[model samples]
Target: MSRGTIYNKDTFLTNVANQLGRKRQTSSVSLPKWKKSPQYDVFSELSEDALLDEFVKQCEAIHTEVIVTEMKEIQKVCEQVIHDLGGESLVYWEDPRFIKYGIDNVLEKKRETGMDIYEWSSTKGTFNIEKAERANIGLTFSDVTLAESGTVVLFSDKGKGRSVSLLPKTYMAIIPKSTLVPRMTQATDIIHERIKAGEKPPSCINFISGPSNSADIELRLVVGVHGPVRVTYVVIEDE
Candidate 1:
């Protein structure tokens, strides 16, 4: 190198620092303790009814429909929607709650509606998987919902696979009022406690907010491009 263009490592770093207007940080720093602020603990004090009302309002704001129903009227409400959508087939999680709630029996009854209900399980064979994929609607039960975000929390296990929500053209979830929480933080705290108690988390935990949408191509927003185009939550007052 010529004398006029001479440079050392220290000189180069100094010049760069001068241009960037920042001092190089070399010390390892630790983050301060996380103290919960007064406003940080929002939604923990909401009443059950208030939470449900807020949850319904938030869900509708995201283009997701919220259906309020009682435990006894669940089957009727499900049938009404299925008829309205011309839903020929439905795929539901193989959960015992469906039976306990009487939805399974009502759906299984042969009627002129021509609606067939299929139960999804992890051990489903090839034939069953194909049926679920072709089903017109997907139904699953959510354990919790964050009202502020209009988010439904679903954990996939042996009876509940991700495909049940992904494969169908439309998706619906049955949420109980007892499972309603204020926000994700509240839901996560409960999960953390459960883990601390030696409980294994499910393989998949889905926080579904709205219908599947994408604008990756042509800048045109498309709904249900990858998953369901429509999502509905039937919030049952199971109290």
Candidate 2:
């Protein structure tokens, strides 16, 4: 097809000049100033017991179940929590080959609750998000942060996916109390050290402080908006 062509050098130059002027104005434009700087108390004074109690209260308020245990009592506590939550708990010895020992407990809890349990193998294509949405709860082991934020850091490598924590209605995280830190600075240092040692960070690093909540709607607080409505931390202590 033949296209009509017209040439107006002066008009074209004027248009180019106008475009450049607009570009210059945009480039020099300044963003709106924020009203205030975000504030966070990274070094709050909180005892281990106080933190645990507060964490437990937060979990309970969100209808989550906390299963505190020691290394030796993981099995028993897992069974009890499952039974109390009206879920069946079974020992899947074969799971150890693929899933972490702590995650196996969470999977057992899901199994008791009649949820399907599958090993997250690389060959197993991408996970089904729809199925995960229907799940009542998700359980996993976290690399506990020693920071005072009471955050649980989890990587999305291996069988653990970030979706498992976000998609489910409830999330039960297993953390060792011995790994607790007094502040977030310490947590960052630990992560930095790991990175310095030539260790690749996990695909995801989630710092969960409390259940998913939002006060966006008319300033009325709501829980479980974009993620799990309930988050329970099972702090494992030494016997």
lDDT measured at residue 57 in model 1 versus the true structure, 0 to 100: 84
Error of 2 at 144 (Å): 2.1
Q: What is the C-alpha lDDT profile of model 2 across 22-137, one tens digit per residue?
A: 42232455659768633334335677766666656655655555667777776667555544434422221122422443556556566667756544443344544444566666
lDDT of 1 by residue, 1-239 (tens): 13355559777877788789997555788758667655446776779898888888887777788889998888899877776655788888889888888877767872335667788766765666687789888888888788888898988878787788888888888888889888888788778887879987877899998789887999987777788888888888999
TM-score of candidate 2 against the unseen true structure: 0.64
Instruction: Report the lDDT of model 2 for residue 189.
Output: 67
Report how far off residue 198 is in candidate 2 (Å): 0.6
The per-model lDDT (C-alpha) reads: 0.81, 0.60
**How big is the positional error of residue 121 in model 1, measured in Å on the Cα after superposition?**
2.6
Q: Pick the candidate with the highest lDDT.
A: 1
